[model samples]
Target: MKRLCTATLLLTMLLSSGCENRPKQYERTQELFGTFVSARIFASDEKTAEAALDAAFRRAAELEQTFSPTIADSELNAVNAAAFSQETAVSEEFSELLGLSLRYSQLSGGAFDCSIGQLIDLWDIGTEQATIPTDEELHRTIHPAAHEVISLQDRSVRFTDERVRLHFGAIAKGYIADEMKEVLQAHGIESGTLSLGGNILTLGCKNEDEPWVIGITDPFAPQEITATLEVRDLSVVTSGRYERYFEENGVTYHHILDPWTGLPSDAGLASATIISQSSVQCDALSTAVFVLGAQEGLALIEGLDGAECVLITDDGTLLQSSGMDAYHVKQVEK
Candidate 1:
């Protein structure tokens, strides 16, 4: 199952001008990748905007089929089915994405893994089959480093264990969102907002006057917000236990699984948001930092260039990266 995002768009003002010199907003949304995929643009012509939006949505659907582990005939599923027994060939795009994900996994020290499908199925969070899991099957699953269990020589993949499977749920949508942005940029759309299931990416500034405003959802109150970030040409992604969970008995189990423990993360954070140029990084880091908690997570962000994060702890402590002052980040008063 896919994780949820806590970042929402707060920009509601649209400029509709009769002047041909001014750009106007055009938006088109569709349900894809198990979430609402919307593409908005500030283009001078509707024809250009519509074509770009169509291309973006089409690319998203194609990627879903390529990456979805649940799809029995998907490339990911094919790899899962064959990689255990023999070296399997993957598409060039899949190979590139897998290598990048492995780097993130290494950077996070196994906090983020693409090879997490087996444990996901065992716990089945966000599904009817979800159940509280113990450490009984933890060893049966794989949480290896980049090259520990899998070999990727010549764009072919082979898993060391039969139980090892790849799941892109934590990163695919964000990658797709980035690709969407590229497609829009190619179509001559410069300014817009993209919300692919809470992976928010802004294309340029709003008329060069202000940056796009992104509202971080309130984990305590879904209808309210906790903070807002003013950013441009950046991706903002948040991950938390606020959604995508199942309650068993009296305890709640979230979908954010810690690969090391094979259990729901106990990092003691309500949510963690990552703001960066790559929505793909924002997507994976959100889950990674949630498992990392505040201290280590903040340090990780600081070490990486062009990245900043805001973490909302379980006890209502708001933590920020050292470079947070670079942006106009505001904490919404309760």
Candidate 2:
């Protein structure tokens, strides 16, 4: 669902035409985590570049195996399956991710939660059986007490409620993207791009002087862009109701469910895009901000030191955080 805007396309063309010393750009794209994941490297040779890209993809696949909720033997599934009865010992990485998810859930005052797997299954927004769950079904499945039910102790997870389920879909892609960047860097890659679906991270600048240009999608018109950002060594993660939804009886339902209401959040905003140094934070905060809406979401981004946000309301109005001015290039006119 990510698109390269006109500005970025033009920049890439210009760079390629004018710069004779532009390192060979090698790219690998594959299906991972149920989405298109790609890695582009600027390397001097093909063999080294392919090896590094392979490592990055392998790391992504490994992380997906560990975290995917639907995967039968994932550590997350193990915790969900066993913690209903007793404490579940998880890998250090699994515990760390769970701890981080819990922290974000608390930080957002339950606006963003990882313990919404039951509700997700009930709604099934993106699958073929996607449908609206009844009030009774939602009431029975929704559990907003993730912080209280889940406990992390010595890399182990315990659940007080037998029904508690863990879902990291909101933040797992960003975490995996960060790990891929690390793998690329470990292979001496100084400049590259990792696009795990819509979560985009640029490793260093596009070149010595130009920053990577990221297109902010127009939620109302998915084919167009609302704005473009010039950034370097940053992560841009966007969460939008338009990304996944289903229509029934003239009413449209989105995938972003509010933990408190156990329904798709109608927070007066269509999308929330976050720019941060850490892709994981950007991913978590984008969902949090979408749930928080414009006023509170902007406030949250402003309070964070290395975070900025772009919020597009349901009415098509665009709003940006105070710190976003530095990266904002030019807004596209409707």
Candidate 3:
């Protein structure tokens, strides 16, 4: 649960090596998804680029309202209020996204649950309220199993458990990135990069056929880069313990909470990076693999079709899926 992104412009974040040279780059950075969303559009002229950027970010803003679990008026918040009591009607888009989230929750054995709002709030990892609670406190908070509680039919959400609540912080950024990329493409913007916080989704390749290069953030050193990769029309997303954590009595408490234990995950992974055609998949699977730990996480990525990952283990070792070699050209920093 990476929390509290700085409300600032995208300042050449450590995630990507960045683009250079010509194609009429039109860049705009705005704060969204609790982090800065930077869009770099390469179009024919200023007007085309501006229109694409405006339309793309407008869609992003709409999604921010629709998907935010904490917002009072958000659709997800509405579902949380009404789904347990009634068959709450949701948009076709919301129904579809929730369906995908449920599938992922099953696949991860609940490691990447979206229905853990209570558990997350209990931990309160990024705020002053964050503390190591007693076993009694853990016992009291009930994180409903997503499989047992949630049901969807005909663009409506229905659920059985009162404990179940929606929290889309994990998937919304990537989902919005995937969407903004579509908006850009629909506007006939050929080459661009749309980054929603740490999730970097690229449009067509840079300068025609060249691949976009992205750097992996160093988990141990948040200010630095560990490695970089070449990719085309692909997204690079990382979920790491370093994103949010606090030290207490010589023990480090991070924000990546485990749904099973109602505490932070000690899953032997400092970070997990998923490289895929789909940004949202990268988003969900990155957190999933991190919470699953190094060995099991690597195995999970290897088994999945069209997905590859680079895992940073707790001991600071780098591991990768079988096909990661195709995109992994740079050795990680020691």
Candidate 4:
């Protein structure tokens, strides 16, 4: 699982695309789960933005901590550990998030299951223990034995099976990005980008001068930008096996795993970036496409309305869904 972010501001923007109308008081807040938050919002004085960012980070950190699986004391971990008897007694926010995850599980046909924690632990993808697990071990730990195992009723959830594990690492960042955007909107700052890690949400156009430009990182080369998308009021999520992985001998193993096989999927594509109204869906879809690989993933993109995708294959082939052609990007030379 990913570490819960405290109120810290990391520079998420690159190659600014040259605009005079940037936010003056853009502030960011930092917190380790709501307490001790540092906020920095941009203003004429750089300190203003820094202060706002600090506050925003703190608020985000609070939420992350509350929902974090890695946090031993978090409510999320408690639920997973069966710390609570009745699902209805859980917090509404947690319940809603769980509901969203379950819906995505059904919608993606288990491709975006949140219950693959056990399988991830087995492979230990980023650790020294990284290696394929035995069939028995894999079967015993990896989750979603059957869709019928998960039940949601009246804003509450229960995983009928005890062995089933859940991991929101696949979709949490995008959801956080969306959540941050909402926070910015509530603050009446409608024209800035909120990016968590690499998941991005463009709130409004940059001062009506230009659409926010978001970059798609080159899967083969980390520092390079394979494409740039211009958009406003939209969320963009990209999933790739490039950054996080472990290489054993001659083989490379990345984090994205196929639920069906309990192994990394060789889905012809190195990366899949999706654009949609909901960051939650974007998060789930990116994982689903990564699992679906190229052909079927592309078909899934085509099947959805108001959804667009750009898929880059392992062989350097870049394909865009029909409606997504407008966001097709030009490689910017570093």
Each candidate's number of clashing pairs is 0, 0, 0, 53
* lDDT by residue for model 4 (60-137), tens: 776687677668897667767772234534676666666788776776777887877778878887667788788898
Q: Please, what are the lDDT tens digits per residue for candidate 1 over residues 1-334?
A: 1222222222222223345667878988898867888878998888888898888888888988999877779999888888988889999879978887887888999898888888899998888888766666777674665446777876988888666788888899889989999999999888999998778989988986688989999887867889998998999998979779988788988998888888889988999999999999999899889999999999999999999999999998889999888777899987
Considering TM-score, where higher is better, how would the candidates rank from best to worst? 2, 1, 3, 4
Q: After TM-score superposition, what is the CA distance of residue 29 in candidate 3 from its true location, in Å? A: 0.7
Candidate 1: where is the Cα deviation over 4 Å? 1-18
- Superposition TM-score, candidate 2 onto the true structure: 0.92
Candidate 4 regions exceeding 4 Å error are: 1-55, 83-88, 143-147, 332-334
- Mark the 10 consecutive residues where model 1 has the least summed lDDT: 1-10
Query: What lDDT would candidate 2 get against the real structure?
Result: 0.88
Candidate 1 vs candidate 2: the lDDT winner is 2
- The better-scoring model by lDDT among 2 and 4 is 2
Question: Higher TM-score: candidate 1 or 4?
Answer: 1
With a 3 Å backbone cut-off (N, CA, C), the pairs that clash in candidate 3 are none
Error of 2 at 212 (Å): 0.5
For each candidate in turn, the TM-score is 0.92, 0.92, 0.90, 0.83
Local error of candidate 3 at 130, Å?
2.5
- lDDT tens digits by residue: candidate 3, 59-120: 99999889986567988888888898898899877887788788788888888888888777
Residues 232-297 of candidate 2: C-alpha lDDT, one tens digit per residue: 999999999989999999999999989888899999999999999999999999999999999988
What lDDT score goes with residue 298 in model 4? 82
Instruction: Look at candidate 1 and give me any clashing residue pairs.
Output: none
Off by over 4 Å in 3: 1-22, 332-334
